[model samples]
Target: MSDLQVGLISLGVVLILVVLVFNWWQDRRMRGRMREHFPETDRDPLMGDVTPAPGRREPGLHLAPASGDLPAEDAVDVDPNCEAVIDVTFAQPVPSDRLHAATQALRAVGSKAVRLFAKNDNGDHRAILREGESYASVQLAVLLANRSGPLTDIEWSQLWTMAQNLAERFDGSVEGPEQARVMARASQLDALCAGLDAQVGLALRLGGTRPVADVTRQVKDAGFMLHDGQLAWLSEAGMPRFVLLYDGVQVRDVQSDGVDRIDLLLDVPNSPADSQAFSRMASVGRDLA
Candidate 1:
């Protein structure tokens, strides 16, 4: 090989070696930092003795209830059965407003709802922060399921990041259930909720296209009122019984020449159970048809 070509080949090999060494150094530094933050332990203090008792189902994903040192208000806002929780214990009492302000940005992680609860000097846990009260610790909870789906990995990571930041800001220690356990619980909760969720829809297909304004007028005349851009059939309590859309788009946003199809949907989960929701919705669908 020519001298120039040989030199280039040697240079390429040295660059590859340099990149590998740099990656190794970075990884080692990260590991060291992690070890400092999360030292090895014989057992997880949060999940004391995971061995299942005889003839009982294994424990579901949940952190042990806050000790006497934590807040009782957790029951009011955080449901352990359907939430992943992180507990932050401060070295000293902190002002409620300061902690509240720090957590405002963490009210939501992705689509999952996040809630914060603090334990005041009176030993009561409260969701609402009292400006003059001081709190010793706080609990953060992320809902695992909703209409959208289960809590995803990205959302979990975001929650963890927020919790870590809170701990650093307050000079506190962070404790939480293992991520694997939390994720398993989330999937289970999502499945249970999905089984109970129900939505009914009916489509009306016209013989010919009709102007948007004309259809909207007829719908309004039929007692459907505009709500959040969609046509809604409201109950005596002013709650939506059925929502109407034109070709799957909001009635107000349909920009087509005309609308040939419209759909009516009843979300059972949000409807009042005593209303004979399905029967009434079916009757409405039949009448509309």
Candidate 2:
């Protein structure tokens, strides 16, 4: 054989050996890490006994415990009656009384996922409450927290916890924590009666009489760009109609009877708007309805 040919063969042999050694070393490192985090799972068939898949990059992928293993924190002693603290707040005099009374009313109505708390602040009545798990819930919390009445720390804590839990549960999924709370608050408004003693008007306004506003607020709060306007009937037989707008466009019209049903009228164009007239019409319809 020629001297040049022999030299080329030697170089090829050395390169192949280097690749083999590097792959072996990498496999060993991955297997070591996987073994530290997981004990019961089977090893990948193609990889070494302790190694994960070659290209896996998911965060905490190797850190998962056995599928059914409870978190270690569960082993610690805990109060059976202890509830998760959600939020805290302070409320003023008349609102505090109203909140306390409203809480009693909510209990009487057998409301689920609703709570109310009240306290005296140096002779001023104060209160706080939590409604549910969506946007309506936080809106209610905000309204309660922002009202003219005195509020207490306890109420604020409950509301905050409720919001945080909802966010954690449904944050990235459709209809997240903000939406859940908002929906709940809207339902509460649907249940409100005409002759209710307190400022029912303001509550209805702040809580929103229709789902479109609640949904719109939630979409905005979730960092989504608004695209459509909505108006709807919040009452059965269209007794109480409401309108909702987004980005200067009408999206829905809602009407409902004080009974069991509400209807939503949506304004979706077949194509994007061209003239300003269509935009104006949608806006006017939303405001007027």
Candidate 3:
């Protein structure tokens, strides 16, 4: 072959080898990250061609690097000691004037982990009404763990619902038909959540992948009715169950049609203690009143 022809052939071979090396390195890095985060799962990112996209960022908290430099068939171990614990207090029947007070109160305990609790009109703590802080943490962990791009609404909704359903289906130590009752109540709660006013200032505080805290400081600021007292605590199927307080008296056995969004009441046991508890957060009342 001529000298020019031989040089061209050599150049082509070098280019091919470079491309191959680059691809292999990228795959190794991607797999390393996934295994580090999900050590228990049997899935392999390399097998599925799951490449981390450009500019990937997780919401709420930063994720740690992959578990190790080697490719293992299993996931890495999670550091139990590193996990965070958030303490929340669900204070309710907050009026408008109490909004600032609640904020101030939340500020007093402000760490990234601590969340203040505010109640809805029915008087049951929203966090208690939903799943607990651990469930919320799992949700946060999922978000932080997912190093990919933004999840579509449907994607996020599906995951969120899955976590919730899983929590309901398996109630830790609780057993038997108790699982079914949880599902029914979740269905009912679903209907109630949809009717909540956007202005009510409802928000979730992300702890890991779960929303550990549900704050109603804004609802109190909006001047909605506030109640205190342990009304009714019913965990039945067919409707979203809540603690109910009526006429400043709490009752826990009332069930209502899934409509009327605004007037449906939660029946928790009522008392002067409930009233006093509700009034203490009066700053919320002032904002909404």
- Which candidate number has the best lDDT? 1
Report the C-alpha lDDT of model 1 over 171-237, residue by residue, as the tens digit.
9999998888888898999999988877777677765798988988888887899777778988888
**What TM-score against the true fold does each predicted structure earn?**
0.50, 0.16, 0.18
lDDT of 2 by residue, 148-172 (tens): 2222334444455544443344331
Question: Which model is ahead, 1 or 2, in terms of lDDT?
Answer: 1
At residue 12, candidate 1 shows an lDDT of: 100
Candidate 3's C-alpha runs over 4 A off are: 41-189, 193-289
Off by over 4 Å in 1: 1-77, 199-265, 270-289
Model 2 error, position 95 (Å): 52
Clashes of each: 0, 61, 59
Residue 170 lDDT in model 1? 86
Order by TM-score, highest first = 1, 3, 2
Off by more than 4 A, model 2: 41-289
